[model samples]
Target: MKTLSEDLMLLIEREISGQASPEELVTLNNWLSADKKNIKEYQVLQQLYRGHQTLLRNNIVNTDEAWQKVSNKIEILQNSNKKTIIYRWYYVLSAAAAIFIIVFFAWVFRINNQVVTIEAVAGNEQFLLPDSSSVSLKKGSAITYNRSFKKGRSVIVKGIAYFDVKHIVSNSFTVITNNTLIQDIGTSFLVNNTITKDEITVFSGEIKCINLSTKAVINNIIAGKKIINYSKGFVVTDFTDTNILSWKSGVLDFPDVSLTRVLEDISLHYGITVKCLPIDLSNNIYVKLHFENQPIQEVLNEIKLVTKLQLRKGNNEFIFFQSVKNESSQIKKQK
Candidate 1:
């Protein structure tokens, strides 16, 4: 059997429901004449529609109410028919049944597939899933799962998130980002999805990563390991940074790291831009610091004391620059 496009399916539905325009009717008629297969497909859909109505009428306890709703719609269609051309009453009844059954099943499908989206308006938005798995979304990050998530544990992540999945026997938890799939083997993991690449850091247990486009298994990322997936390929590496979860943990630790790298982490943690004037100044400086649940200003003050760089704040941004006094002192020394 040939697969039908949604447009063709909708067209068939409109025709069956007696809602097709004259132009649409002509197009549908042409399609039907084009192939015997089209006729068979249409017949199959009609049978399914009628079969569902029969099953509902026979099996449902509220049969009267259900029948009444369909009858009312049939009456409305009949009354609204102003054309003088008389048709068989059975044909009109069939049309009404087709409309109700098609619409009813469509509504049921939509309800079953309804998506629930959770977004982190602020950083460190933590919540539990229906399966009792915990999720921590970074600010501006969002995750979507079907309403029936417990039946199938899967979510699509946008931006960055941390997952502590609750394992259930005979069931699997999976995270999807970009075109990659990360199937958790009872694990806690962090996923960072950017435009050009996706980074997965497994904290505990293991996860099987796959490239959805190529259907190739990338690697089984074990605990304390990470994987960077680019469009062309992927690379698996050890976790070099211990403070990767700083955003969720509310701890920013820079252990003897260069000033430039520290500023990058600070910017990401605070969701702001950090710039250093005379960029080379930041490159030459290094600092060791630890902050837990401290305000950005306090962190900046500590950095200012350690590196002795002037700090300035603007809208959603921070600047570290060489102080004018220090610049003048340097000029005098050079002279």
Candidate 2:
């Protein structure tokens, strides 16, 4: 039989950090609900992690020194064994010290195995994970993991990233977002975490999408598929627009995509605010356009031309609304 997948261990770590996405929470719940044994195992591991945290909070002593002191006391006890006065107490203390020494070293070893965090600011960054997996992070994105990646591969991701996970026998690659956890079976994928939704698009292989809150897990997301976790529910849809991820190549593509989402991307990339958007056009219209490192003003001008909207700029904020016939007539006269 095959060994247990490492994804389960990664889920435990996410739970410990309180970063388990709603989907991840759901997946964990499902696992626990499946069997009482699973719950017992999870609780035991949780207890161990908490114990380690407590030990780390307090300053640890030198193991060598501690062992030496215990040894010296044991030696003194052994030499005085002929004296019946405290022979029974010496045996008890010796056993207790032996157990304490073992526990201390184990705790120290666990504390030494720490997690590493990588972040991208100002621009995109590339990272080679400890397991030889490659990660591409967009600006403002981040990932965190421990050194034992190959043995127990997992990452906590924030913002947007492209992941090319390396496959290892019996090892699992998983990414945790704000609302979902992606367990990569063997795949390359893109993950974006935004305020309204978390999306995972698979380029190749397959992945399991887990809802952390509901303990619902979907294991059928495959190549050319995208899974989205939204406020009301989740959606798994197929996408054929190859350039959907053009942001990786400095190109932005909005193909019948929501204008609000487009504006959010613009704000994120250009570091600008676009406010006072008329609610009438918020969800009724879709925009189709491509931009290649275009200036902010030029992009706004394009929106005005395409949507027949008027923009007023003040303090780096652009306010736009549908143009009135009088305003259009005035612009025509000015031209």
Candidate 3:
């Protein structure tokens, strides 16, 4: 379907907000079971809906009751032969609804029409937020905030973004993701939510990074700190990887980082493949380098020179193994 009918959208919203009738619940459930995309669409709507108790209470203007009122107004208008009367009634009702939208839910979200979406479709896109804070969104990342930016200064981030929040007295800033909620107390930070891991790096402020599932403090990161959760165990590193946000400045800085980590970052940054052979080249071996708008080939050559490893190329994949004179059987291609 090109679009869901207005009644269906209202039913979905009612269902999400615990106001759907039993019949409407069954109808929605049946619709949802018909297609997996239906569930995703509902989730998108739910994510876009803000969760303030006052807003929720205000928006609970009953769908059935409001529709009945509109219907009654139409019936009264129909008694008059003038078509202009009907048009005027519709205009008045629409204006009232528009006022409600502006007061309760206004703009980007289609729930009575009010939600704002900020995305970095290309490279790093910088946004000057409504609260005078600043955000630099990395490619393929997005954030959704209220169109009016009322209630509080908050945003839900998708991929990676750097935030320089302008702290308002008594109002804190929050950056939310699927797994964590980072509350910033007047500071600068970087949040990276990649496919494999979720990380929060604080550069010039303190933040409370919490696990959404457990409500546990993952880390209370201070200035010059980082908290990374990947592959199960988490790492709370202090005063480490201060240059983590270097990618925002078009500089890939890795000072004394493991070959494994270096390659991982290279793969993510340049969109290339770098596989470390399983051979015990001693995991302690590290690389210290910085690349500024350099080609992947030059970066690869730098790795080859520093590690003395042979790079075997195969169809968009690069495998680094021990020198040819060393064990050749330990070569492994990274997926």
Q: What's the TM-score of every candidate structure?
A: 0.70, 0.61, 0.61
Evaluated at residue 288, the lDDT of candidate 3 is 77
**Candidate 3 lDDT over residue span 1-335, tens digit each:** 34988988898676555455444544565565456587567656654454333345666445456567667766677667677796878776895686557544432233532347878876779878888898998888898775555345557778989999997756657676665667787799888886566788888867876654444565457887778755353678776554466557768887677778888778877767887776345254576788898889999999888777888897888988786675644323232
What is the C-alpha lDDT profile of model 2 across 1-335, one tens digit per residue?
22446998888877765566555656775675455587557655655565566565664545567667666666666555456528746665876677687776676465444556789987889879987889999888888776545555668788899999897656667786656767887899999987677888999988898765454678868998998887556898896655555557767778676667677777766768975356546455467878997888898899777766678987868877766663433122110
Give the Å shift of residue 15 in candidate 2: 13
lDDT (Cα, tens digit) per residue for candidate 1, span 1-335: 88878898888666554455434544554565456587556656644544455555665335466568656755665555545224435555776677677656654443433457899985569999999999999889999775556655667788999999998756777776655778788899999998678899999988987664444576568998899887667789999886788888999887777788888888878877987878777777777889999998888898888777788877777898887778754311111
Model 3 scores worst on lDDT over the 10 consecutive residues at 105-114
As for lDDT, the candidate ahead, 1 or 3, is 1
- Counting clashing residue pairs in each candidate, in order, gives 0, 15, 6
Give the least accurate 10-residue stretch of model 2, judged by summed lDDT. 326-335
Error of 3 at 32 (Å): 18
Q: Residue 137's C-alpha lDDT in candidate 2? A: 91
TM-score of 1: 0.70
Candidate numbers sorted by lDDT from highest down: 1, 2, 3
lDDT of 2: 0.71
